[model samples]
Target chain A: MAFEINGKTYETDEEGYLANLSDWNTDVAGRMATEDDCDLSENHWEVIKFLRDYYEEYQIAPAVRVLTKAIGKRLGKDKGNSKYLYELFPYGPAKQACKYAGLPKPTGCV
Target chain B: MKQIDWSSLVINESGKAVKKFMYVNRHAPHGTIYPLEGLEVVLIGAAFDQDVSMAFIGDGVFQLNKGQDTADSGMKNVALTYGALGDYEVTKLYVEQESLDERGLELNDLMNLTWEDEEENWAEKPSIQVVSRAQLSDLLEQQDVILNF
Candidate 1:
């Protein structure tokens, strides 16, 4: 789906993903952040970017264990710890981030 | 603290044997060990001195499908476990319809087992109540001693 926000045309998927774009407007970003239940911050983007890469590669959303390992490798061991991971996405990282990324809930999420 | 009892491994709680159990299976077999572990428990539920009801939902439904043919998966191929269920007195098998569709599976995929009592089969499991997502929560709310696989 394409939208003209503040006269800037942008594209997203049916689930509201920014198509081939990195930057986003404050309001839309905020909305996405709220939907994902994460406070808007640089840290959240790290997880979000990781999720995008995961979905791109596996074509399936990862559960938290997979997410944490991937994050630990890319970011650092501190970020990948289960307690820290849950602190970032209280409802659960893989679940909340997938929602914010405008993707369907991952398989085996339950 | 109430001790958790695996269905297959459990014969008596404290001292008395229990009957009329509800067994819930919650995983797919391949990626996780939960499925095989769940089946072992289900077999116990069947061996219990009382009646047992089996509920297959989410990826757990994979356990009941017939002709699974997975001997090469380097596991016990626990798919055969469902066939032996009836032999052990586990006659009632209830599957959530929504979960079937979500996984693009159907009743036809299951073993040619008898439907549970017609009352539950009318709606939901009609045997035990095939729960939709919300219905699952409600059903869980009603259980007294539930064993999840």
Candidate 2:
């Protein structure tokens, strides 16, 4: 699948994960959020930025549990809970947020 | 490790090409569903008659440590599932020696797993093998696919 932003088409897998990591941009993320039927809120951007930073360092998208703990440690207890995360990304924090972050799908049981 | 000529052994007994699959366990059993789910996948793969193996490295070795009692933890004792792998015909289990030594554990500290060899009139056979890091690396290189957990 492909999406257009500023006249440049960005490719993605069938599940909507970015086909090319280098193709990620703010516009692409906005488009993805729109496709997920979600409006990009400040809270959503916060999680997305955190996920991109984490993927940049670890080269892997963390599972939901690990992501929650890390977010709790870095952000705050209020923003760290799965309830709040799910409020932002109704599908799944790790799967959906990581897609917007243009990272690979997390492996393993998650 | 014996190096068999791949060209000479193209098809398996079922006339289908065999694929060597290595499942890498890098996390402990509990606190995460990796090892549990990894074992489930291995069982499913084995049912398809694939050449399946598991490598316990780093914290993954903790999954096989003996004297585990999950009663107090309120979690099911999933480690016992390792023993059933033999029945699934998924017997190749490699434990990294360096990982065990670093953690101050020996082979005796792990669960004694055995498999029934039907060809040998139901004789019991050990399923686990402790190998050096270099040996494990060689084994990893030979796998057609490696599923890291």
Candidate 3:
């Protein structure tokens, strides 16, 4: 699949995940969110940034439970629960958020 | 346009293409990665907007037993992950009744899972259902794809 932003076409896999990880940017995330009918908020960006950083450090998207615990440690308890993360990314924190963060889809039972 | 097998397309009431995917979990949790890995596949499958369901049979029913704490074991307590299935649009969790009976378990022994119904102003709905072994077998026949773990 492909989507256009500012007349530039970005390729995505069949599931809309970025075909090339390097092609990702805030604008790309914004476009993807728009297509999903979701408006990116500050809270969403926090999770996206956290996911990107987590992937950079560990080379993988943390599972939802792990993500919740880690975010709780870094951001605080209020934003760390699975419910809060789900509210931010209704699809999923590990899958949807990671996709927007420009990382490969997490493997194993995430 | 290229030829398309229009009849092969199955769309749900909401107008999204959907396939009936059933994830079978038959292994005990914490011992093997099947249950956890199976749930992962269920979540990812749900993201594709498919009609997804899960069945807990055999020793898998033990995965849902209540009051499970792994703090001492130093393992990531994944039992709570089952509660999040509804949030991922995977609300059809069928627990085999015979499996529970044989293991001396009850519905109340498992976590109470609920999902938000966006169409109903986000009203909460129950996600887990205890089905008889025969009923579960019928359900298995209806699935377009079955992922066994």
Candidate 4:
């Protein structure tokens, strides 16, 4: 599949941008930083990938409160906790991360 | 391009290339978070520029609450879903003001953040239509396609 962002065309696997989006989870956030073309820090990747997985399962992006604890439980150490999650994505973690992942916005947000 | 008026909680978009949509989130959170249904519509709606309106009524009014807590149950909340609708330039977010007041919620405290400033107070913002039982029945009759969640 091909998608154009900012007028640049890029080819993706059958699952749309899932391959590229999923590759940036916590461990690979930094390595793919240059490739993904986003200056995303690890913290940024943490939230983004979490949101992607959440969206994949439920088919709905989660609000902040859900992002906070879900990350905390899954990654351990609260993964920066609520305050940290807010710092990473002030416009709201799920929304910001989804944009970075090149995925559609989460569903039923608000 | 299937034209669907999705006021109910049924997820009409799955495994397809949706071209037209009518999202109606008529169920409130809590017992009927039905966010999943609305969420599916919102994401798909954001992918195109057709007839897509996420209208809120009845208990579904709570779907727009500012603060939500779904993580405790290991579930993600529905805030971002509302935010992403703008990316696709959703037609408009319709809210029935009467629904909020009836639930003891004020308009200011209820709304998805994605609709901030411009979109939040969009001139085309959802109408807070307060109606009598007679009005609701009449309104239902007027809709070409209606979904009740």
DockQ, candidate 1, comes to 0.01
Error of 2 at A104 (Å): 33
Using lDDT as the yardstick, the better of models 1 and 4 is 1
DockQ of 3: 0.07
Report the lDDT of model 4 for residue B28.
66
Instruction: Pull out the clashing pairs in model 3.
Output: none
Collision count for each candidate, in order:
9, 0, 0, 20
True-structure lDDT of candidate 1: 0.62
- Between candidates 1 and 3, name the one with more favorable DockQ: 3
* lDDT for position A97 in model 3: 92
lDDT of 2 by residue, B3-102 (tens): 8777734566788988889999999889899987887677556655678899999999999999787879977677766765665676889999999999
lDDT of 4 by residue, B1-149 (tens): 99886664333345443333445677767565576665665554344433455567777777778777677876556554565444345635566767766788876776534432333433334323334456555555555455444
**lDDT, candidate 3, B1-149, per-residue tens:** 89987886888767987888898889988999887778767766654767788889999899888888887998767786676565566788899999999999999988778776757966789888999988999999988899899
Predicted model with the maximum TM-score: 3
The TM-score of candidate 2's chain A against the true chain A comes to 0.94
Ranking by TM-score: 3, 2, 4, 1
- All candidates: CA RMSD (Å): 16.5, 15.7, 12.1, 14.0
Residue-level error in angstroms, candidate 1, position A21: 59
Q: For candidate 3, lDDT tens digit of each residue in A1-110?
A: 89888898889888888987778899999988887999999999999999887665434566666577668767988998999999888998878998898877774433
Q: Flag regions of model 2 displaced more than 4 Å.
A: A1-110, B1-8
Worst 10 residues of 2 chain B by lDDT: B40-49
The CA lDDT at A54 in model 4 is: 67
Each model's fnat? 0.00, 0.00, 0.04, 0.16
- Ordered list by DockQ, greatest first: 4, 3, 2, 1
